[model samples]
Target: MRRGLKISLVTLTGAALTLSASACGGKKAETGGGGDDKKTLKVGLAFDIGGRGDQSFNDSAAAGLDRVKKDLNIQTEEISAKPDEPDADKESRLRLLATKGYNPIIGVGFAYTNSINKVAKAFPNTKFLVVDADQCKVEGTNVLGACFSEEQGSFLVGAAAALKSKTGTIGFIGGVNVPLIHKFQAGYEAGAKAAKPGIKVLPAKYLTEPPNFDGFKNPALGTEAAKGQLDKNADVIYHAAGGAGIGVINTVGAAKKLAIGVDSDQYNLPAVAPVKEQILTSMVKRVDLSVFDFVESVSKGTFQAGTKKYDLSNDGVGYATSGGKVDDIKAKLDQFKADIVSGKIKVPTK
Candidate 1:
């Protein structure tokens, strides 16, 4: 819990964050009274690419915030990210929240690694949670690292694809080609191979790389990648792309093929309700659960530092069974889950 980011610190203010929030999504007014002894908790969130409504990662974090806001009577503020926003902007956003006296500010993705590290050092009292990024290495009683075993979840979905695929061929699409996304691809490929020995797993394609991270948002790139895989006779495809996953699902449905979704349950998403049946399953990374856990701890004054690893054993990451598309293979999938949890199956990280 004592890791640190080596970047220099920067100061941010409430006015700056208010303006940014307004420019991105209309800001929500803080509801609690401005008093030192107020019972209301002040919470802040800085969302990654695709923000709240991309029907994916950011939305999952928002779900946690929304639930706590209602259940705990807390005052909350949220901000979204612009494509290619520099690290300085992320630091400013975090600083804005902490400077305004919000406790336990959470950054929604790994992109906030550097900023969180630098900012956590400056504001030693406010809690900071970084989801999906372990490299931030922020160590202190106030910083929490909420990371997931994405590969473990992806492996489950990949097994489903293999079990259900009539074509013995499948594909994978990733948002970026970093170690993080590579973990997704490796686990997926391993799961498919484990389920169906010698199955033809197509080479994974990435939408973009760092400094050009639109791969997480642009559905067009997802569609193009999925189409290529489908053209190669891939009947089932799994994607670890964030918002871009919308296009992957659409293309799969149009071609009457099967798909595996990431982050939130795509089948349950209202935006993709019409094509829900097309999604056989989703690698449900429980960002909501993690966020809620942090919120509860802070509220109870039990805030702790260090990384909380969400793996198959903790039910932190798993494949969704909505739509009953994978019902026939449920028992088999359960066996895989058990084996993974028991450590008999060591899921590859990269």
Candidate 2:
């Protein structure tokens, strides 16, 4: 738990994580919160650069927690990522949540991997869940990792993009160029090629370096990238760029360009509510479902530990149901979805 991210944008480093076989192993204790009928569970969430309401991964996680609150009648606390200080604010949020007695704390995205790992050491008794990070060790079996096979979903989305594009040109934008992001890119490329042999995809990264994943927080960059793609006659654009994807949505709205949403249901999240008109469909990853599933496991005595991956085979990661446009490619899109679901098609994870 003493590990820290030396580099600005590097993901959670293994050196920063210290896990012992018996970290989360001990006697089973009874749960007592406020000792009341409500049984209040104060859950904490540390969002990524996109923060909450990004209409993407962060929003999805929040939505999951929201469901937990509704179903379990628990209270929730949240923290936003700061531009000035990264880990300190993240760590402070987690620590404060722990000190305030938020039993189950959840950190959204890989950005919190460092803070969560370090904080996990400080607060051994409190359970935590971290998405997009695998560097931390679970203490007393109280932590969970929420990951996704984004490539699998992106592959299906890519095929849909290729088949649906009347212009025969498509575009893709990623918030960061991490290994996970690369998986989306590789899948998009392969799927597009598979669908249309000579199709051309305009791929652009929000930034050339990893130092600014928060660049996903900047809508201006997303707008510019979308405009660039639209100008090139890309009828449909698929974006995996966190909050930056919101900018893409905005630009698509103004330009009347078709945009493919990512993570959560863009049509449902606040960030995309303003631009629902231009969103063709979204690439859905059940990050929210995974997060809730993790917490529910703790409640059910089946908490899983280690690097668990949620791939298409497990219904953990896949494309979102096409909005009103699912019928636009109805027969074909249905086949693709079923193919992946029924093993008729294997979406590559590379």
Candidate 3:
């Protein structure tokens, strides 16, 4: 179970009020001592846009940090990226955490690739981890790149969409036009074609172009894009957008059509509880596992540099079966997964 944003408001004199909020971006409450042998570990997480309550990508990363605090008894600090902030802001965020002695700092998205590389080189002793980026593959560097085979997971959900669609038309919506989201689109198209060669998949829709990443956070954009696809008779749609994907699900579900989620199981997410039944499945990218494993390695004194890959073989990415929506086709989806894992079917990432 993942946690969402928690807000609290306090009343003051004369109808004035104060608001104190705690969430993934908040400083975690310190835990008790471990012992003389247990060295206190401090982790810093820089969340991508949409932050914790996103119910998708960022929340998955936060789940990893939550586990680190619980199992390792460590102090953690989290900072979120602001909408359309400059690269300097990201650098400053990383440097601030490093200066505060947060070792093995993590940047939760590919947007931090350059920032992590620059910061890790300066602070050679403090390790860094960047999700969805492979810039840390240089030898002797103190940074680890956690990359996932997102296309493989997207492939499974794409096949599910093809198998379940009654109208023979499916669609894809991406938050950004970046290469990362391209992988999702490519795999989805490939999988859908493999399942039903005659199935009609609409042209991929993107909410925003590069350098304007509001696509990942803007629900209104998602709503508009999804409505447009629905108007075209797309009965099944898959979205790789982050928080914006909520709009895609809501619009599709309200139309009595099916939608596929990404990153986390949207069916179980509190954000989409109203439309749980409409979510056919999710491309579950295990960002939480990758983040937790990196921190665990650091804690165990076995942290290593270079890229660590997650794919169907290691449960790094796959399709979710929440809401029993995909249960009827689980065997077929599993077969597709097995074929990909066994190198019989290669998923595209372009």
Candidate 1: tens digits of C-alpha lDDT, residues 1-350:
11111222233343332211111333343422222222335788888888888788887898898886766656577777778989998898788777777776899999887789889898887778999775536666568899888889889898999889998999999998788888889889989889999789999999998889989989899999999999999999998888888898989888999989998888977656667888999999899888888877776556678888988899999988999998889999999999999999999987
TM-score of the candidate numbered 3? 0.89
Cα displacement (angstroms), candidate 3, residue 220, comes to 0.6
Query: How does each model score on TM-score?
Result: 0.88, 0.80, 0.89
Query: Candidate 3 on 315-343: residue-level lDDT in tens?
Result: 99998887898899899889999999999
Where is model 3 poorest over a 10-residue stretch in terms of lDDT? Answer: 11-20
Taken over the whole model, the C-alpha lDDT of each candidate is 0.81, 0.69, 0.83
RMSD of each: 7.6, 8.2, 7.0
Q: Candidate 1, 70: how far from true, in Å?
A: 2.0
Greater lDDT among 1 and 3 belongs to 3
lDDT for each residue of candidate 2 in 104-182, tens digit (9 for 90 to 100): 6788777777787788778766777888774333333456676777777787778888887888888888876676677
Indicate whether candidate 2 or candidate 3 has the larger TM-score: 3
Model 2, clash count?
7
Which residue runs does candidate 3 get wrong by more than 4 Å?
Answer: 1-38, 134-140
